[model samples]
Target: MIKTIIFDFGDVFINLDKHATEKELLKLGLPSITEDLEYINESYETGKITTIDFINYYQKLLPDVSEKKIIDAWNSILKDFPKHRLKFIQKLSENKTYLLILLSNTNELHIDWIKENVPFYNNFKSCFNFFYLSHEINLRKPNHDIFRFVLDNHQLNPVETLFIDDTFVNTNTAQELGINIWNNDPKKEDITNLFTIKSNLF
Candidate 1:
């Protein structure tokens, strides 16, 4: 019996063009997505660095690119939050059937953009018993520690928890810890169909 539900914010709830940032960066003369760049991104997501530092790092890498352009390129991955998904989660919350939690590997700028764009962000947040932003928590997913932290903090049994994420790596890590997972494919699957799609788990 899944008593708790953990959801990934990107793709799983709010839509995201996962490759948009890389594409935008390339247009801005990023050269290529190097290992160093990936490290910086992971650090930023885990709150290891400040927003200013993140922008500065990019600025140094691409001196000709303006700060505004860099910021825009970075946020290009975000997309609209569909109303139907919001309604489904809201209805699910109203039922109060499970301990709902949201865990997302997000940074400051992206969240600021979401706050400005997503009108029902507050209402959506209220639906979850716990809401954790990776930067705020200093923990990002696909990391065993983050999953373990959530399980330990809430006294949740991994066997009784279901984690839904669009990333295979994240779901794989969670599954290794004995947590049930739904590796949702954002392209082909809609989160609103969660019950019908993963009805066997319930």
Candidate 2:
């Protein structure tokens, strides 16, 4: 009955160091990531703020950290893209067994980072029918509103929509909305190996 598949980009598609950027920030010596900084990040994700503005705002916190260094360090979180996983999603997309969609709670800095670092970023994103980013949509995951937004917008039946994410918190939110969910471990499990067929997906 599954007719739609929602994929989370970080752990689901690309290799990302979950804690790398935050650790780098702490090392850079900010008193802490401030509320204003969090606002800038949220604003960036919703497309309400520009990427440059977000970088500049965060830079002010670390007066000594050059913009270029901050940018590089921020982007370091997105490590690499495994070729086989790309091929798996590509193949799954071609078969058209489900309405393939992608959803991620990502910000402008990350988007710009991927644009410059991942040569095939755009092409790979094109594989999805509706690729939704929290910053663009002004909605983030682990929040029920975003989950509901996707379900309502697509006229999707949650029972038939499988949501896969590395974050149990996000998937759990979707699960509460009646969406089928899979929480996979990036270190121990990969989605490419998770699904030989969507029917038997975890």
Candidate 3:
């Protein structure tokens, strides 16, 4: 009875090197991941701070690192987006079998990079009936409010909505709210195998 599908964008669609950014930052003199740094990142992800401010904070921390280098390091987390996934989503969209929704906790810089690097980014976006970006909406995942916002906005039944995310915490939150979930492991699973992997849901 799953009528609406909510998908995460990172790993679930575009490949991401979750550790790449921190590794790259270390190369530019970042000592270690600190509490303040995590706060800043979460703030940026939720649009609590502007991009210019984000870069400036890093510049202040690593005075020797140039703006361009910092930007490059930050964006290093993004990787190749396989076309097969695009085709899968596109085909699903054409069939209109479910109410497709994309709910991602992505920042502006990463999205800009995707638009520039992923040739079919726009087409992929169009496949979704609703596209919600964290920074754009001032909300990030693993939080109850954000999930509620989507459910309320769409008037969707939690039992009839399936949420798929690479992160367990995100899926966990949705499950707590009564939504069906798939906490996909990007290393072993591809979203193209969705129906087979979670066949019972279909």
Q: Count the backbone clashes (under 3 Å) in each candidate.
A: 0, 2, 0
Q: Which should have the higher lDDT, number 2 or number 3?
A: 3
**Candidate 3 lDDT, tens digit per residue, 95-154?**
999999999998989999899999999999999999999999999999999999999999
In candidate 3, stretches whose alpha carbon ends up further than 4 angstroms from where it belongs are: none
| Poorest stretch of ten by lDDT in candidate 3 | 106-115
User: Higher TM-score: candidate 1 or 2?
Assistant: 1
- What's each prediction's TM-score? 0.98, 0.91, 0.99
Instruction: Name the lDDT of candidate 1.
Output: 0.95
User: Clash pairs of candidate 1?
Assistant: none
* Candidate number with the higher TM-score (1 or 3): 3
Q: Put the candidates in TM-score order, highest first.
A: 3, 1, 2
Best by lDDT: 3
lDDT of 3 at 42: 94
Model 1 worst lDDT window (10 residues): 192-201
